[model samples]
Target: MIHETERTAAAYAAVLTTCGDRASAKALARALVERQLAACVQMLPIDSIYTWDGKIEEAAEILLICKIKRADYEAVEKAIRALHAYATPEIVMLPIAQGFGPYLAWIDSVTR
Candidate 1:
């Protein structure tokens, strides 16, 4: 059973970020897992339309959803910044409020 503390503690999180291309996205995903910062990273291709430098821009992007611990959020952001191609990358963290107990436990086991 999942406990209140487990459900509410900001420990479990999914960090989201975007890469300009597949190669970079794959590299970032591998690095995160290798460093034990993320237990898993799910990547998807996406089309992004946004404003930058006061102009609307569009590009093909790859989104990475990293399952990680809240404690590693800073490190994750730092890594993304270091490896990302964009001057300003999109790094967002969403807490995992509730999940399968076994899967959540696996995340804890795999991540430092």
Candidate 2:
């Protein structure tokens, strides 16, 4: 379990974003990490099937796994929204329970 202090100052959130293609994913990932809103962004290619406008849709999507502090969520969200191609992108956060001390420290250092 994560302590209160850790929760207040630090957190890990995976921001799910899907781009039209690989190029867009790369561009978004680079921007996020460069801005420091995210310590890291992992881009993954995935096939997705969903419903839109009462129709079934299937497309190739890219997932952006963003590692960031709790304090940075707002900034991260703003940046992603600005860069996203979709009018309303999927942006969600999940709290990290615990992490390795050294790596967590590194995450804190880089993000701060």
Q: Residue by residue across 3-104, what tens digits does model 2's lDDT show?
A: 544654346655677788889889998998888777788888898898988999999999888888877888888998999898878888876766766666
Winner by lDDT: 1
lDDT of 1: 0.89
Q: lDDT score, residue 48, model 2? A: 88
Displacement of the residue 30 alpha carbon in candidate 1, Å: 0.2
Model 1 regions lying over 4 Å from their true place: 1-5
Q: How much does candidate 2 score in TM-score?
A: 0.87
lDDT of 1 by residue, 60-80 (tens): 999999999888899989988
Worst ten in a row by lDDT for model 2: 2-11
Q: CA lDDT, every prediction?
A: 0.89, 0.80
How many clashes would you count in candidate 2?
0
